[model samples]
Target: MNKDSAQTALLWIVAAGFFMQSLDTTIVNTALPSIANSLHVAPLAMQPIIIAYTLTMAMLTPASGWLADRFGTRRVYFVAILIFVLGSICCASAHTLGQLVIARVLQGVGGSMLLPIGRLAVLRSVSGEQYVSALAFISVAGQLGPIAGPTLGGWFVQDMTWHWIFLINVPIGAVGLYAVRRFLPTHGETQAPPFDFVGCGLLSLCMIAFSLSIEAPFSTHRAAWAAGLFVLAVVSALAYIPYARRRRNPLFKLALFSEPNFSVGLIGNLVCRIGSSAVPFLVPLLLQLQLGYSPLHSGLMMLPAALAGTVAKRWIAPLIRRYGYDTFLLVNTLIVGSSIVAFALITRGTPLAIEIAILAVFGAANSMQFAAMNSVTLKDLSHEDAGSGNSLFSMVQMLAIGLGVSIGGGLVNLFSAQWGSAALGFRFSFACVGVITLVSAWIFRQLDVAPAQPKVRAPATHSAGR
Candidate 1:
């Protein structure tokens, strides 16, 4: 093919990879109840399915860049598609929750590389002038995944079977594999720096320990295991400090924290997302299990939130410019938190219009919150630190998502058992998570009030394996 044709084909290839990855990130949420039934597990007990995939992605994301550089992008991308396809087949074939969780982990292993490597491929191939537009084009595919995932999952679960939620990826992955081999350029491997495997392990351990601790409430020996894991998490986190400091090329430089906004924004992102991330996981269950909505209806209800979030993205820059990061994040965080809390009031008696409005308002505020948080966190990073800082930020974002689901599911399980009502449990879970989000407002308050500079990079939106 000609140069222009090759580049265009490359874009299509990468976009397809992105669509597959992003689609899987959300496609399983609406199918959880069905899958739980199939696997003979409680619906609330299914958080591990989501947690396994997200946490695996979180743990492996930092390695994706290194792997791409060590191996050629085309080779790695091809392998990634192959593994993802295999994982999807395994998921469809799973008869037990254990088998499904293992399959999801395999899927996460591939997903963890897809977007990062795909973006890297585009960066190498596309001209600098066209880079932003190319990314914007790819991002549309990412956005469409979340928008289409739930409804598609619902339709499959209702009309066919929950297995199709995963089976659907087989055709997409087949096409992606063909495209990768045929269209993607062999960029050839470059010698990369020694990866900070130890540092990465420590951080990954910290995240895993913490997540497992949250999940321990469901275990028979909850207290002892939870305490031990929580302590392990804290110790693992502390161990990384001196370890990173001594290394010539650490996983992430501690100096990145010197930027006031970076520190505040990172903390706020972690804390705030712990609440908001649970909404996607919890809302579907709330609609179907508690409110008696069908799978399709539950999935359809998510449309308002997703659409509102898309529309609200355009408003983020203007609002931040007007109010400054400190003011914008503080106020927007409250709105987001309030919106999450308001879900507690949702019930069969609640008007459909009122529920839709709540979803829309939450969607807008949460979208702005992510954009503003991401921009402020990375805005001040020096050129030298930008890449590492961004990688660490992405890892934390995925970690937060896993934690949110773990905590949300744990809370519901705990509360339902105690309160003897699943409905009350869902309400209490919303309230708890909402309060967690509200606490982040204090973190955002620490940002010095200054005129908001235009974002140096696009706000990191949720993608499959970001």
Candidate 2:
């Protein structure tokens, strides 16, 4: 057909991939209890399932730009779909916790490239006039996927098995694969640079050590091991900073951070996200472990939050326009933090409806926080900076998510040890995390109050990453 039509179809394909990735990230939260029960692991121990996906994403995300430039977007997109589909099959077949974690790593390997490469493809092919709108459309679809994922995952798990939540990806992935192969534009150029093996290795090691350190308390309860990991992480990171600075072509350009707004927004995102992302992973475990709620019941309880988050998106932009990003993020961060505390207080006697209401409010604030933060982060970045900056932000987002779940889980274990009550541990953890979220208000306070210009939105890649 026409080139314009092909471009439109191209975005649709990428949007499908986005939806699949988002759905996978969120859907599993509700299904975690069943998966843990089936595999005979502690429900609290299931944080790895979430960590594996996000950490893999964090580790691999920076590589996508290079891969896409070297391999051509069409070829990479095809491989991405194949890897993702294979990952889904592996996940469905997993019979043990280790197997599932391994399978998630594979899935993440595929997913890590999908959004960034796809966005790069669009940015390369689409005219500037059509660019943001295309990105916005894909983003909305991706956001809506999470809005529906928990409810649908719960339904599938309750009616069939936890396996089906992943198996469902096969069909959606099939559609995505076909669409990418048929509709996506081919890249005519090749990137001539060789990959940076040393830098990649050091960076990967740093992320792995940091994420695992967060979970160390839960597994070994050895503060010494955790302390060692912290030191290792510091070394690995310090090595990368100077190495990246010295390199002619680093894995990520150090220049991206020189943009004051983007740099600050990136750090703000990581901090803000750790607080919000921790809740999804924590709430499921709290419901089933502390309150002894059934998997189906807990999933049902989370539905309101997802629903409210969706409805809140429409209002987020207007709110941003009214108060500006600084005020919006500062205020919204408090609301999100408080919601985590509310969930922390949950127990068997907690009113089901009231609990749902609190979660619903939490979801809305979280959505608004994302929309605002993402906008401000990218607001100053231009087309040239888009690739590395977005990729860098995406990496931090995943890294934060991994840290959030791991750290949050570790806190749960700590409180459990001190309080001698699973319920009390969750409450204290929630309050602590809540206070952490509130402190982030200080992060946004640094932003200047520039009134946002309301405009039509398009295909920005939305990540379920923190």
Query: Across residues 1-466, which tens digit of lDDT does each residue of candidate 2 receive?
Result: 8997998898888888888888888889988878888999877788888888888887787788778888898899889888988998999999898998999999999998888888889989899998878877877767767777877888888889999899989998888878877788889558558878788888888888877676776679888998899789889988998999888877777778777877777778778778787888888778877777777777777778777877887897787789777777888988998888788767778787789889999988887777777777767767877766766677777888887887787788888888888778888888877777777788878775487774323223336312
After the best TM-score superposition of candidate 1, give how far the Cα of residue 361 lies from its true spot, in angstroms: 0.9
Q: Where is the poorest 10-residue window by lDDT in model 1?
A: 457-466
Q: Would you list the C-alpha lDDT of every candidate in the order shown?
A: 0.87, 0.80
List where candidate 1 sits over 4 angstroms from the true fold. Answer: 218-221, 456-466
- Each prediction's RMSD over C-alphas, in Å, is 1.5, 2.4
True-structure lDDT of candidate 2:
0.80
Screening candidate 2 with a backbone cut-off below 3 angstroms (N, C-alpha, C), the clashing residue pairs are: 132-458, 133-458, 134-459, 135-458, 135-459, 135-460, 136-458, 136-459, 136-460
Worst 10 residues of 2 by lDDT: 456-465
